[model samples]
Target: KSLTSAGRTVLNLALVVISSVAAIGAINLSTRESSDSSTFLLTADVVAPTLTLSNSYERRDGIVLGEGFYNDWGHLAEIHRSTRVEASTTVDDCLYGWTKVDTYGTETFTGYGDQVEMIFESVGWNGISLLIKCPSTEQTATYPVMVKYVRREIRLLNESDRSTFFDTLYTTYTTEQVDGERAYGKKFRSIKRLVSEHLLGAADKECDHWHDDAGIMTHHIAFTLEMEQSLQSIDKTVTIPYWDYTQDAYELDDWTDSDIFNPAWFGMASPSSKDHVITEGRWAYMSVGKQADTDGVRNPYGLLRSPWNTNPTPYILRHRYVYDEKDGGWTLPGCTDFSSAWSYNSLGEYFDELNGELHGPVHIMIGGQWWVNRTMNFSATNGGDFLLASKFLWRQGYVRCPELCSDDTPDDRCTCSCPDELTRYFRTSRDFLDQTGLFNLSDGLFSDWSNFATTGCMTPDDCFDTVVKALCHVGHAGEMFTSAAPYDPTFWPIHGLADRYLSLKRIQAHENETILSQMWSYSHDGNSPSDTRRVCDWSKVGDTMGLPDCYVGDCAGHRAQDLLPMGNFLDRNESYTNEEFYKFMNPRNEELPYIYDSFTQWPACTDQAICWWNTDGAC
Candidate 1:
């Protein structure tokens, strides 16, 4: 069952009230002094059992066919994960393995390494903890894992509308056997979910996923989201990262040109999906690290998928607008005598406003290759999609908590498995956690990705935050961030942050040739007509790299006052017209946590202000 907008609003309001009451300690049901009364400060602890080599079978001959040759033969990477024997526990160890299979039945063995003990301990919110020898198999290894989230589907109107929607969307495949060679191979796949019924596609007769199962397809949307964090700790596991793709024979360099992104061959790319491209054109959305533009006059926002190599050349994103009679087609937006922001009425509009008939949720399908299929840690399609979404949230605003800072209000627990990319940023920022929460099997870093497959389909409401935090941590933004604010703390500081804005900018330029050309020039010559470089460059922007050194401790023998002068002022006390501050601090909070105290005061200021930073070019 999916939630409607009204339902979402209700849920949001209910949560706000509940959270507010909890924070102020206003709603107490206990009559006498409670024996165990402690103000709850949200915190998370991550734990993953250290994998140890119990045994391994490499290039072992296994499986058989009718002929002399072995039908299924492949090299295996096997090992066991061991945990210290505890007085209360029954199991002390876990065994696991990873295998690389070849089609021709030839096997080659690879070496395995040491076994680390799984240690479950308590940690402070502000201290740092790490798994001493976690398995990566190889450097740049990305273990495929899923981060599950809650999704809500909505049907705007009554039964008639609902019936029509289901009719067009729901379809089942049935096959009849005629000859030994097989007579028919027709499987039904619904297209109604691909294009908006209110837009140009529904009536088209050519759409394949279209059907006439009125009641079933009536759902206008399938809005899935994270409700909490979902993580797990396994005795033993395997991890394969993005760099692994380069090892594949068929993997392509660029997403658009790669087998993974190809719609026809691999069946993974869904360019026709509403969320994949700009409604104005069939241009697929591109990321920031990938954008480059050289020529000043060319389209800066153009869909850029550069050819193999160019010396010092900037390849900005570029896309083609191909109009087709087919339901899924591109059309550009424009204005003659009037001017209104193309996608929104005003800047006040949030993502919900942009998620209209023209805009759609991204659909990611993961398992096209064997590498994705064999792993229990991740679901090829759904897991990857959710993980990406989770990473985006973490990158944009989420902050990491040190294990030592347990007394303070920590945003969420850090699983030791928090993406290494993010851990680098936190370590650089000195945001280590020493002790605050207990690190058990449930809260371990390595465990989070593994929990998604089960928690996603079942305990969605409870796992949303966990999923969001985990995904956000793994993505590229973690290493890129130079700030020290959690998602909520640095809302304004990081609002319109580097990654997301660039993504939006790329989409905006997809259909506008003039804008595309301008973006191209800016990317290539560092002359963005729209001054987008300010948003793209972390060094120039107000990131952690350029911030004043506000730390004082240890061997330097410096005075604490000098390092943290006006440390009390570190707490926010601004009276902004909006809730940017609360949003900045407790970003994931449904309702902002209002902190009223002189200890939590911000210096009086009109415009957003930061200390010791100069704009390189322009804003």
Candidate 2:
């Protein structure tokens, strides 16, 4: 049944009007503003590209509204707080068998180690749907997880106002349960129960109260893994399975610390979505202690080498750890877990003791959790999985493994225990206080006899001051002072006044070694001629573009294609996977991760050509 020309024209006109109305609906939703003066709005120019126009309205801007309407993975903010769990292994069964004239005791042991570690972070929006991508593994079978999420004061801006709104905006999307399936709904309820137990206001079932708030709502998602759950395993996989977004289900004021930082705020990649966004899209910073140079030997310091050394390389920063007495020496109260937070908290306390509590913002060390994705090296539970303990091992030289040590053997080894590692990680945390003369100790350049006037210690009383200077001379030496020295310690021990100084030097030296090792490996590994840049005088084939001479050390010889066309990150340590390279080399019809802005969109390649090329290419 073919329609006449008149009927066809009417249908076409109807379709255009419907699309326009839908676009308008999307705009209206995004433009809901707060009562405060900081209310957000979307500008005409910014959203015009996402909208379609009707015949009566001119399509001057060609805006296609709702294009970015869904809160996809790329633009969401991550809120993280430390959490913990406990697990223990117990003997399963025992039996006795008679042999000859004697009865022997036989034992069948099925033990489960109680798992406990700070669930430091989670990603999600307030009171919205959440999906967890639990890797498929044997451990997840027994202890189906009871995950929790907590949302705090942070608001998700409903921006429809300003030009910059779209740049920073994120959307919230939802999912529904299948017919006749109560299991999915029940599982989601279990997750909420865990959040209630650990977080405030969750117990009252008041999470829905957040809808009444005047501004954007923020709900944190948290989950508790059952004893059978193995978070570090590759085979274990789990998703939110379901969500309850009723306004009454969330209570923002009841949110606490644990509630503020939960993983559901950020979603994992779906089977059809971009892998990089779920696994490694955002920028994460690594804290490199002194092990940057260490070889096969992996001590406490070596733990710092995890993801960068094992997974695809990401951005990295190498610096000394600072110590603070306030945060209880990097130990969070009621939680035995150790992390960068413990270090920062300790430093904050230490500063307060010396300067009576700092009055302003403090720079804190950060370690990203994307590396915690099951695909990376840190996911496994092994003696060497701890960076905090490893840093201590490197600092103290050696000690019996605390988590894996034997009670029968005397706990004696040069190797560092967990506490010692925490100590080492905080090496330069006090650089600011040490340089401000709070403790009154001065050395090196400042101690120069010729520079008595500048040292501020020329007087008899000043000469006796004894505060050790920080590892780096990075502080402002004050207005009148000049010749502020850089903390390049040539000689300093791990103890006494020189401890911080020595650690700083050791870290730098190690970083240099990491750079050199990777450079050499990149140059010789031949499979991806495109992977290794021609940092040297080596000639190129085709569009083999190398980075500028500025990358002499770390990123030397790497091509612009090696860096750009994916993202413009400056971290040299992050490396591309073999699959990524195949797609890059042959990108015409190839579904590639590099093509769609972030690594999330890059599709994994399976070309036999790539396999043969890499194998025979020998790189």
Candidate 3:
């Protein structure tokens, strides 16, 4: 154990050589290029995380994020939900319930980075990852993950052969939004599986929630839930997308007549289409999983959609904050923008007013899996806990309640005869979706909403539970509430709006650790000031090269200190027995990886407007 100075120097030299070899190994793993070229080398500096690196989800860049108080509740509702927040009783005083539901940080995008963003207007997780990769190909090697990387393991390099290698990889690997420059993966059919593999590949398998829980829960992680299992069962690959009717201004026109219903966009027209097969748009020619079938059969029938309000629709784009048909296309504000009606004022207003105004209308409009007719809201079932039908009663179709269903019926019919219990907790489609008694439905702004929020702790509420019911309505026959939604190809971008909303709010409020600390410290909430940022972006506190496998136990010479950190992301919602919730805030500081710009103005490449989803335009 004891060595002279010369002997110690020799030992240290050997240690240095061994370390150098390990560094080379990391570089080689990341640099393993396709057979054609080994030009792409990834690193943290050239590539930044635009996704919300929420601590709960192992820091995967977010295609989904958190909001509202109930969602932040650390345990399942059975753990500690208060009497005032119970879902069953709230419907009795629906308006009163809306007012009582806390709006803390419950905002979520169920089918995140899904559609709309794919319409050449938004950016999905798969898309975001691609952006980072395309540019970073020319980069020097570094650790796979940026946070708390081994200091000298991955060496830096500023020089390389002048190869069009990265650019070629970009064009060949994927494409820009609709008709932009049509590269390789735009057709939806070609890249579905690969994209799925890529996203799941970035995650840890056994780290809890979506991985082993049999469903996806992305409030704290950038996961797509049991979708992967469903896809795996069918030997399929990938994600789904959600299409909101309010994102564009088409109430004036017949929605059914619009191109959105074209096979390339939302799906085929409901009446004429059969077997749930999509026929026209980019997704027209692909195979996707089904709610009724588990074998992952090819949808013999094309996708279907019968807009509830094709004629003078109430779901018309209320705020005119539209993303053009291209992924990187500019975002345009309405001639008479009304987003303030949905986004401004109190956070509660954002959720309550948006129920029917923004969230609920989409359910009724789709009238598919989440069909909204008084004719059907419940039926007797034989087994399980809360199923897909009940998701609408709970979350924004964001997290899954697998305990509510049988393994065989995971994505199918919920045979559970718990209607009374379901009814008690979940709001009726009609009562929950009413647009008349909104908390603050006017087109007014929350005067000093920014400043107060900046200096205030997020007040937890049940309003988020109500919004979840609206966003995740379960009556329809399609993808509304199921583990297989991601297979649809349209689910991600539609939900990307949720992620975008929070990012925009953070931008508008000019929030930071100082502001968040002021709120957490001054608000007198149970959480300490440091938790605000650490909870949102834990890497600041500490991080490591994520484990090589999905192992939940200690591995790779490090312990999983936060293996299942800070609650299982409101699994119980109002059903939990605990009163505790993480009153933390989002801490991502990079220029938004994605933005909803005004297309009419042709957003410039300068400033924070670089075309995040573009090809030729300066991104």
Candidate 4:
């Protein structure tokens, strides 16, 4: 309708004010909707889900290689709008963007209920990628984990690490491969071949090079390292975990109850099988390969070779038991006081104690024999057989026939009353000698007996005493008891402990400014004269004992400078001299590439006045 100018102006002003209020109201409505959208983003699939590591089982330093790390991801579901969490060891292009996913590594993600565990498997810089996704869009988080390569204590190893180790060990042991021409002749890459190589070092004879001498530490160091390399070839993460048996000896009331004998570990220490076959754990029903014949041919019994039996069956035997005399299990020395080894003025003394006290007792503990009474009748005969019986009686301390003969006659029909111990020894010795063709009637009993009798004796009484002493040495059973100890899987861990001891000794020597190379004296038997010949002096072939000159065929002799008998078992490209092994024995050595998690603790007492329990208090 037509109106005056003033009325129209007033109406226009009023209309302008109404329009401004409506515009402000529209802005407020838009802001309210935006707030509602933000709430929707919190509850729905608008923004990416937050991903984080709520908890991790890794040490503050770094993750252990092969051991792996456990991580919890429950915090990723903070928004909880159909959230998804995925983890991978490998990341293709996470640097480009969080949503960009491409490739994964060899290690599979293992976890349950918003958690993930992963093994790096290799040393050095490794990374883990986590991808978190809501209903729409995804975010990624990468963690740089440094993995350490080291040999750890068996008891301390996690389930995954232990599994990896055993898996690699069993694979390496079982996987057979023929070797090309190298040291100690060509052979297969199997435990059988390892046993054969060890057998060559001694061959069930008194005269030997590798054992009970200064060379023992160096030789076994090389042997065990070679074995470790073989296992590493399969799984790069695996290191031979040392079983600190001293822990068992000192910590436990019954060492047999150690977790090392659990099914997940080395298995049953005492098997229930009549054949002594291990029937539980990872190595259950394992075959030891074919037993070699008398002529060293791989024929006859498809089992481990044993001097106790001519036709040994296919089985790995263990006779672990407590020696009644000790009241406890076998006492493993160097529990708290490694002074027994480190206190020695010379390396010779240290090695002597190591071999006799530490090494030999373990073998006996694992493979010692039980005495049992048995009655048997023997029909007397003349000629070589009669001479054999008489020789046996003489060796057993029955100097005259009257001492042995129950009928009180030195005739062919004379009956002998033999002690069970002596009888068992005689039978085992005779059978072993006969089977191995070491001694027989054809060799002329008088001459062979004379050589054997004079080899380790000064007189007839000395000879008889030597025979009695030899009984304790040879009364053991099973593969570990013999020179062919590598046949038993337990041999590796025991030797690993020995290696650890070697490392400790090396460190102690270094601290004292005494090099192992400086101390050079070969004392196999305490009675035997010290053989001061250097290993480089190949002219000296025989051992300290004046026994037959049967030395290790490949190596020179027992000295720090001697070339280790690597044989075909070790890599030919590598130079494994005794000195090289001596250097490798140091855990801190750069070339060693690995270190132990911990070492056997030394005694707290630094001086006589400082008692262990009261070092910080009044004496």
Each model's TM-score? 0.18, 0.19, 0.30, 0.54
In order, candidate lDDTs are: 0.20, 0.19, 0.24, 0.45
Q: Which candidate do you rate higher for lDDT, 2 or 4?
A: 4
lDDT (Cα, tens digit) per residue for candidate 4, span 1-619: 2122322332232333223422321011110123223322433322122232221212422432222211111111111011133332322221112221111223244333233433444332233343433322334344333233466667667788789888877865676545312222232245666666666664432234676577877777667766766666666556787776766666677666778889778787767676567888888887777544344312123344433222244567776532122211345543444444544566677677666666666665565332211121111111112222222332222222121222233233322223443335444444434432223332333213343343345564443333333322222245665556787777887766666666655654556534454455544442211121212222342423121333222234466677776733223355666666666565644334455544432222233232222214233
User: How far is each candidate from the true structure, as Cα RMSD in Å?
Assistant: 32.0, 29.0, 24.7, 20.4
The segments of candidate 1 whose C-alpha lies over 4 angstroms from its true place after superposition are 1-292, 295-358, 362-374, 377-537, 541-619
**Predicted candidate 2 versus true structure: per-residue lDDT over 1-619, tens digit per residue:** 2113322332232333333433331111122222432332323212211211111001222321111211221111112222222222211221111111000111112222222222212221111101111111011111111112211112211122111211111110011122112423222222112222222211111111111111000111111122001111111222111111111112232111222122232221111112122232221121112222223212222322221122112213211122211111121111111111112222222222111111000111111112221221222111111232222122222222222222233322222222333324444323322332212222232233232233343453333221111111111110001100000010000011111111222222344421111111222221111112112222332222221121122231122233211211111223332223322222121111111111111011111111111213222
Model 4 CA deviation exceeding 4 Å by range: 1-148, 178-188, 204-206, 291-303, 306-311, 321-329, 334-337, 370-476, 512-517, 523-557, 567-572, 600-619
- Highest lDDT against the true fold, candidate: 4
For candidate 4, the per-residue lDDT at 586 reads 58
Model 2 residue-pair collision total? 106
Q: Tell me which of candidates 3 and 4 scores higher on lDDT.
A: 4
List the candidate numbers ranked by lDDT, top first: 4, 3, 1, 2
lDDT, model 1: 0.20
In model 2, the worst 10-residue window by lDDT is 485-494
Candidate 1, 1-619: lDDT as tens digits: 1212322432332233234422331121212222332432213211222221111111121211111111111101111212221111111221122221121222222222222223212110000011112121111110110011111011112344333322222111011112211331211111111111111111111111111111001111100000000000110121110111211212323334433233211222323332222122211221212222232111112211111011111111212211111111212111110012223322222222222111211111111111111222332222123322222222222322122212232222322134444445543211222111111211243223344554343443334334434333331111101110011111111111111222232333442411322110101111111111111112332433232221111211011111210111111322321122212222122222111111101111101231111122111
lDDT of 3 at 370: 23
User: Which prediction has the highest TM-score against the true structure?
Assistant: 4
Error of 4 at 526 (Å): 2.2
